[model samples]
Target: MEAARLAPEDVLPASEGITPAWPGRSVAVDGANIHVRDTPGRSATVEPAVYVHGLGGSSLNWTDLAGLLADYLDGQAIDLPGFGRSDPARSYTVTAFADRVIRWIEHSDRGPVHLFGNSLGGAVAVCVAGTRPELLRSLTLVSPAMPFLDPRRSFHGRLLPLLLIPRADWLAARRLAAIDPADLARMVIESCFADPSRFPEQRFAEAVEEARLRYTVPEYTSAYVRTLRSLILSFVRAYLPGSASLWQVARRISTPTLVIGGQRDMLVDVRVAAQVARTIPDSRLLTLHDVGHVAQMEAPRMVARAVLGMLSEASSVKLVPRTGASERPKRARRNTKSKRDIPFGGGITPAGEAAG
Candidate 1:
């Protein structure tokens, strides 16, 4: 892959004190060695957590959230096949990654787990939940990829050419390499943050390091292109009659769910994440106004609170289906009332609840 990467001399760690902690083990998935980080001791709790990361991210990406998550449900984070230290695989797709995830679960102490996913992983978790609801207690999706109602809005959607066009992929990668790695990394970081100043310089440096490694690695360009292409393809065809967008699938999800979205995300619109919550009967949604893309990284404490909040709600919600007789016949027998608060103000619902 062609990469605009930074050299070791010109680029340095973002902060002097920051240390990216990576502690874990190795497992096998689809014949590829998978790296894992487990919270000590078997979880003597109700929830067994398994986290999945976004495109171009690995298990290490969840470093910030692990300790907080462990305080809730002692769990581990594992690298998906062909990412991180894991050996490159035959293919990278939702199904392929899901299969690997299922294998990991089977061999883990956390099968039938509560899953957490961000971006690309969020989509995978949703697909897996569709086929194996029994294996999942609930799902927590952070800014999952959704179908574009307006293709022109998202930067990634509009930048699709960087991956789709022939040879452009190579050219971009090469250009990326020639440019200062730290500078390119900053561009990416700044683009994602609501307030770029809030971005951790240390984390940005780590990103640069990762970029350099990815660029130097053979087939990295192809892998990056393929990953981006697959992401777009999945979003475009998320749902039909049989297979719908993951958001659509979320509506049918019987498992308790929490949908977290970044209000300022330039890539995946916040509106879609709200839709994901609305579609699911047992789901609650939280919109982080200042964070983008990777919320846990951007605001770890808030993300932790949200995750814990969802778990608390999930614990109280019984999985039993809601059943009731149709009230439409009786509704026609009674008079209906409606009121409007007027434009530039608010409105009252038919049920009399005021909405602003």
Candidate 2:
């Protein structure tokens, strides 16, 4: 039996209503309530894929890309504990989060999913893929928060370490409290994208609404701060050998992998994208010129196309070269004239030397 393929219109209807095609539900798995955005695929027998969002993000982050790729994959995007609608966990750590995902995969009886993650989730996905290779068919990471010692590349890179300070949560909450949800949304868009103007207004509005709603959650600030601290800690541990090392995890991963990075990302360094690609065996790196940290949000169709291509290709693993960027998907390059050479903030160009 073969899987049914989906078209973009099926998931991305032209309507302007709030829900659109992607809808989410809370599911109890392994004693944890996980918020998963559900999008039915073209066929029932098709294999399932799961998406994990970055720190402070929810399943909503995967909406556009998941919708765009729904034609080819029966997808679900998980909001890690303490994010979205999920209940808070006793402890928040990359390993703990990855364990929750692994347990869900095992409990759901969903074998070897096409795993997708961005930023912190990407780091968790790497841990999962490296530790339990049996649970994944393929892995896709969009700006995975791999280790980079230089803090100058991004504001978050510099800020992450400081989050370990005493009462960092209170400080962060105080900082966030002064900004309106809409303004916060704009700041996030500006920080995450090469060109904030490219973001869809409808989606932008939804994001603002979500931001407003998110503020109401009592655990929001604590979760954000704690997760940021844990993520920074993960970067520190990534240098060590054995299970603690993300590099070790990358090297141990046997599954085929696809890594995506943006040239103008203001969070994770773009150069880390290529470094991660080189670390994982049988993986390829795709660098989107003039794009930002959140490539899936910035260019959904393009990201979806890249994901679908990686999934559709033969299962055989191959070594992609470390030099130069992976070719941009043809569909993504159509409107080159509209894209500007956006400048990166917080001196994020050190990776540019590595990229060269």
Candidate 3:
């Protein structure tokens, strides 16, 4: 079956009142202090959901969307090691990030929870879902940094050459130090949002504050550089035929998936969005026009509505637990009605063709 495409008007707008970042605390996982922002669900019956941010992004990125989904999800946005308030880790590889997430979920005993990731985090989430399908009830990727060989497609392309320069991290740090945090924040807002003018002033202030804090962390620059380099290398590996690439991992994913992308995303091409849905066996696609890289931040209410619809559909099917590493979870009979049958604030029109 083809993936459904949601129209701009079909999505609801976020609440007018902005909420502060969710309450956060440090949790020890695998000998590392991982910071997490916790959003209390409206009811005890709500399922657990974990949100992961992209490279150079912090847990604060998820504040609005987590709050909006509070009724159905007990959400926790995690600051991957070296980002946000989290302590630095020895390694910044995607696999390492995925390992930390796995340990946290195991430590919290929150297996089979809903998982969401944006950009780099989307790649990490893909790693987790592919290797440990038993750990996720569903997967949602927002503008995932999939392997795209064309460097011209994203702003990130400019930095790829830096990976070859010796002590590039130090050079990058010195360069960033020259820019004011407020200016850095503005750059981010401009890059991530199709309409930067539409961003709330208060939110921009918060972003500036977060950027200032990140600068104080000694490992911030190195972490960012290493992670970016690693991600690009992974992309290169993904292109090699017959290799165990992310695309290969994505095909193995069995969890229900939702892939969201902004039409104007400057970092990840919007065309890649449809390709992602087509890659995953049980996945849907959402491409929002006029939106940018951070759809969750740019269109939280719309993201929330699509998420709720997926959750509604997932609830109808029963999942059997995996008894061994080699065993795939058994899925019970799914409802005859398509996921579109589950209302998402309004009617939706299937793109009428397979995702590209």
Candidate 4:
């Protein structure tokens, strides 16, 4: 197997203007109203792709990436229950989140679609790929929030202790409520982006607006806090020697997968990126320097190029299996050199070559 490389044609032009968030509408799936921002493909023949954002992120997170991929994919970025304009869900567990995504795909009759996830969404995508292999054409994970014990970032370390307290979600919400929406948005941008200056002013304003709207939603802060707590619990379960660990789930996934990570990520350790690629049976990894947790947002064009490369390979080989099939789907040839480290502004290493 060869490493996935970005071709000259795959590089998005720098002159391409940033697209605003696609128009969103509510769709009911299993009694839950999911808000989805739809980006129509360049043609009806283009395949479908679904994007799921990380914890505390909404469908808007995929605005740029989805827009860039619209020529090849009809994309839908969904706001999970209790986020964006969606109603609160009864549960916030990772399994519950995966179930929602599965239901949405089934309800929309869009099986065997390209599934893309970031952070928490990546974990949810892992469950979906493992449990319902036939529902995905391929899986792309961006800095997935897999269970890691070492909280290198101060923010994560501070938040971990709060999970031990009773009614911590309420307490956290109360504290968050005291902060200004703009300040909160700024903090998020600072934490998520390796270079905060790269964030567009328009997007920053939209994030501020979203933060203010969140304050109006009664369940907003609680949803964020509880979801974080659930994710932390999942980390515990993943580390324990058990069949239910996320690593085990990754091992079971047969879909062609692309795992992208940020070398300078303040949250997830970059070394884990290689482990993720090695764990997934048919996977490739890309590590980008000078980027942080939200690589999809920080480097949409580069992300889009890698995604297109994967899609090209998947389509050329017709790797997607029929829905509801019992047999394991065909796997792509395993890449001997599964990981590639891309410099912030430099040439890429060729496929199957190790980057120094």
Worst 10 residues of 1 by lDDT: 347-356
Candidate lDDT values, in order: 0.63, 0.74, 0.80, 0.79
Q: Which stretches of candidate 2 lie over 4 Å from their true place?
A: 1-21, 158-161, 316-356
Candidate 3 residues 134-248, lDDT tens each? 9999999999998888889999989988989999999999998999999999999999987786566667878999989977998999999999999988889998886369999
TM-score of model 4 vs. true structure: 0.88
Q: Write the per-residue lDDT of candidate 4 for residues 1-356, one digit (tens) a residue.
A: 23555634423433234466688999877676899999887544678899999888999999888876765788989998899899898899889999999998998897779999998899999999988999999999998888787775435767887888898878877887999999999988898888787777778878999889888998987788888888888888998998789989989999999888887777676666667788898887777777888988887767888887787776642222223322322223222221112234643334555122
Local lDDT at 118 for model 4: 94
**Each prediction's TM-score versus the true structure:** 0.77, 0.82, 0.87, 0.88
Cα RMSD (angstroms) for every candidate in the order listed? 15.5, 8.4, 9.6, 8.9
- Candidate 2 lDDT over residue span 1-356, tens digit each: 01112122222322222225366788888666888888676434456788999988888888767755554578888889999888889778989999988987887677779999999999999999999999999999999988887788876865765586898887877878889999999888888888888766667877898789777887788888888887777778877665778888789998988888888888987689988887887876667776888888776655665565566563532212223223211122122221222322432223233233
Ranking by lDDT: 3, 4, 2, 1
Which pairs of residues clash in candidate 2, taking residues 3 or more apart in a chain or in different chains? 6-71
Alpha-carbon runs more than 4 Å astray in model 4: 10-14, 316-344, 347-356
Question: 1 or 3, which is superior by lDDT?
Answer: 3
User: Distance (Å) between predicted and true CA of 4, model 1?
Assistant: 41
Clashing pairs in 3: none
Question: How many angstroms is residue 107 displaced in model 1 relative to the true structure, after the best TM-score fit?
Answer: 2.4
Off by over 4 Å in 3: 5-16, 316-356
How many steric clashes does model 3 contain?
0
Clashes found in each candidate (C-alpha, N, C closer than 3 A): 15, 1, 0, 0
